[model samples]
Target: MDSGIGSQPLQEETADLKAPIAEPSINLDNRIPGLDDPYEHALKPNGDPWAILLKPEMETDKIQCDAWKEEVQTLLIFAGLFSAVVTAFVIESYKFLQPDPNDAIVRLLTQIANGSNATSSPASTSFTATAPSLRINIFWFISLILSLATVLVGTIALQWLREHQAYPACSPKQTLALLRMRSESLEAWHIPQVFAALPLLLQSALVLFLAGLIDFTLPLGPKISIPIACIIGLILVFLACTTILPSFQPLFLLSGRFSRDSVPSPCAFKSPQSQL
Candidate 1:
């Protein structure tokens, strides 16, 4: 019986050792729910999600977008000059159409009221009536319309250039290659340089038109009116040469054989030639 009791104790010990110990119950509920994966909180301390997720390609895209913004701004400035010239043309046209006759009438009345012997001459009236020619008016109107059309074309071209600057499907490398090709062709032909200069030419034409209109309509004698018109013309020319021309100097220099080799690739994201 003692031997049987000792064997029963040994059997109980063996059975306990053979049984699987329940892994300390995991109790996922106590895990604070979403914190189960340690890597889920991998964001930097500043917590800027974009900064953390940004890639090389995204950085390149941002640089390209910035460069496009600058080019658009410069082109807009050039286009604005066209609008300014158009405004000046309209003002001069209005002045020519509705000249002030009150000054002459007032002078005549003042002489009559003062009982002066001076008589109003037919020559002065004839000159006033014949000053502005119908042909000149028609020419000025047509030129104004053309100037406006030029401005419209420039704006449209700028928009098109912006669209062509980048494409979503294009790999950055391919996009850069295309940008270089375009720059090379444009530089070789120097087309943009010529286009940029058109504003100055149009401004000169508009100024000359205004001077002629003023010369015809002004009540003052030719000695005074001619000099005034000349001064005004000079001022307009000065402004165009000093302000607009210098602003576009860089664009003008962006072409030619020297530029083809020396000019940096148009794409801001492209590696430098030396690096390449």
Candidate 2:
């Protein structure tokens, strides 16, 4: 051969041109589809357990703060109401103690004089009775008005607090499912709450009315009857509350409902029966 221009041996050149091909190794662990995004592993259509837990924890803190504020307001309203009650008692007591314009003996004498001495009768037989002590009446009236105003204001405040935006006790992914759940199931428990409030309100009004009536009608010497009456009324109220409480237990237990997506939903405060 002519050596084809360059001077290397053919076998050496051929051997240098040949390169070995390496086989690719397969990874079993990395082959998994969701491995790159682990968060997808924790979520489901219904919701993740962790998210559910987080929802309640966050809402609880906010609920607790709201409830505490409501308690403070309730206390203030009660204090104002108490002050009003005391003022009413004082005003009524003073009015009772003050001399009455018409005495039984005076009335009897006046009647006789009017019948027998018609010609000599005083020019004006009319007795212009002074109005109940203006100062005391005004104080009692203002106290009552203020107390009522306080209750109204407190009620408005409570309503505003109730309206504050609340987050579901579950993750956002499951929020739709929670909303789909028939919250009407919760009606069973709410009836008792409504009825309970009614009775309590009635009892309060009755007690207040009785207290005022007793102060105005009964002399202080035999006031023990009022306490006894109040005790009886309280016993009735307690009985009613106890009866209603039992009815509420089942609703309270069912408060945690499963959403359509199977996530645990927020606890309902009122029982289902109340919904009716």
Candidate 3:
């Protein structure tokens, strides 16, 4: 009976302890301030301000399909240029392979000499190798001039394009200004290719002219061949010059939508934001 009474009192005390308690409220307004909000822009350091503007716009407006159009155009232009070069090579091969009168004369002379000089020396001895004169055609001289001119033009255009990339676009106004700048850019980008054509065309013309000029009747076969050889040598020189010069490659070739102003963001890749 005594044990039951003691356990009853302990149970009541445990129940009392388990009951919820209401504590008095205390006021605390103490906190430390952080350095600054990272989102609040005070000019985040970046190489391109145009990209900065583009990121925000891309997040808001989505459409990057226009870039595809620019890419296609660039590829097409490159393909056309490549095809032209291939065609030139084919034409050069055709001209070089064509049969000439000089070969026939050389053969005929060898046969006549073999029959005539039958005593001690063979008659074929009289058909010794003959060379043409070294007088170059006016056409070849003109072609050389054109080749040098084209090389000069290509060099100038490459330099101009390099200089155009130095300016920065920090604002929407500046971005729009680049649209105007593109006029200058186009000249820089296009002039090189145009100039390169001069040399290529000249070389092709000279190659054709020399191939067509092999006359067996003309005196000094060796001397005549010299001009053609020089023309061929000059063609090689011009081609070397072109290989060294920076050919035009427009930025739109990568992505036309990329301007001095904007580019598609990784997340907003589909957004087509205009530079202006």
Candidate 4:
């Protein structure tokens, strides 16, 4: 009976040893999932998770760059149109004064003297009649040169952007570098655009002033020419400032960050394993 009891205990112990240990139960709900987990979709072959995240950022940057490029193209077109207008106007005004170019030239000189002496002589009145033509020619000449410069610089920038777009940077580091370089180049190109506006503003103001001068020279009494010219000048100034200023904000932000001699590497955050 004792052997049977002892054997029973031994059998129980043997049974306990043979039984599998109960593993601690895990709460799947509380467990954080990882990208490599089987439940998640598999990554693409040779694909980088970091690169995938960066894709959207790169796309956004590309969109902004394209928009800026279009803006520059529009500015170029406007510059060309302005150049054409100035050239045509100057030519026409020169032809109009050709009957006696010396008369307009003499009139311009006389007017400068008359500015010092408020009272005008009979000869001064005759000279004043031709002064508007000379002033118009001079102002338009300056405007033409400025507008042409804007067109030239804008064209160069546009072509460079096109080429860059065609042969884009292959890697993220290259892309970041290219974007920074393009922004600086764009800022430089924008200088001509902003300066072009100054000449345009001056030319428009001169146009209005000439209208007033011509009014005095005309047999007819004061007319609406000055008011009309003033309105035109205001419109040109508004358009130029509104279009150019917004572009500057973006370029300024971009350039200010990368202006230093030592640019931070885009791959600085990458792991040594990734580099290998």
Best by lDDT: 4
Runs with alpha carbons beyond 4 Å of true place in candidate 4: 1-46, 96-130, 166-221, 224-227, 233-276
TM-score ranking from best candidate downward: 4, 1, 2, 3
lDDT order of candidates, top first: 4, 1, 2, 3
**What TM-score, over all chains together, does every model reach?**
0.40, 0.32, 0.28, 0.44
lDDT tens readout by residue for model 2, 165-268: 34456555455344323233224444224323432343344345444444443344456757766766687676456546656666765785434566544434
For residue 155, model 2's alpha carbon misses the true position, in angstroms, by: 1.8
Q: Which stretches of candidate 3 lie over 4 Å from their true place?
A: 1-135, 168-176, 183-196, 208-276
Q: What does each candidate score in C-alpha RMSD? A: 17.7, 17.2, 20.6, 16.5
lDDT string for model 3 (29-84, tens) is: 35554433233346656555556655554333223223323433443454345445
lDDT for 242 in candidate 4 is 55
For model 4, what is the C-alpha lDDT against the true structure?
0.58
What lDDT tens digits, residue by residue, belong to model 1 across residues 214-253?
7454666887787877778788766545555444445666
* lDDT of candidate 1 at residue 58, scale 0 to 100: 51
Which runs in model 1 stand beyond 4 Å of their true positions?
1-131, 188-190, 219-227, 236-276
Q: Candidates' lDDT values, in order? A: 0.57, 0.51, 0.46, 0.58
| Reference-based lDDT, residue 260, model 1 | 62
Question: Given candidate 4, what's the lDDT at residue 146?
Answer: 57
- Pairs that collide in candidate 1 are none
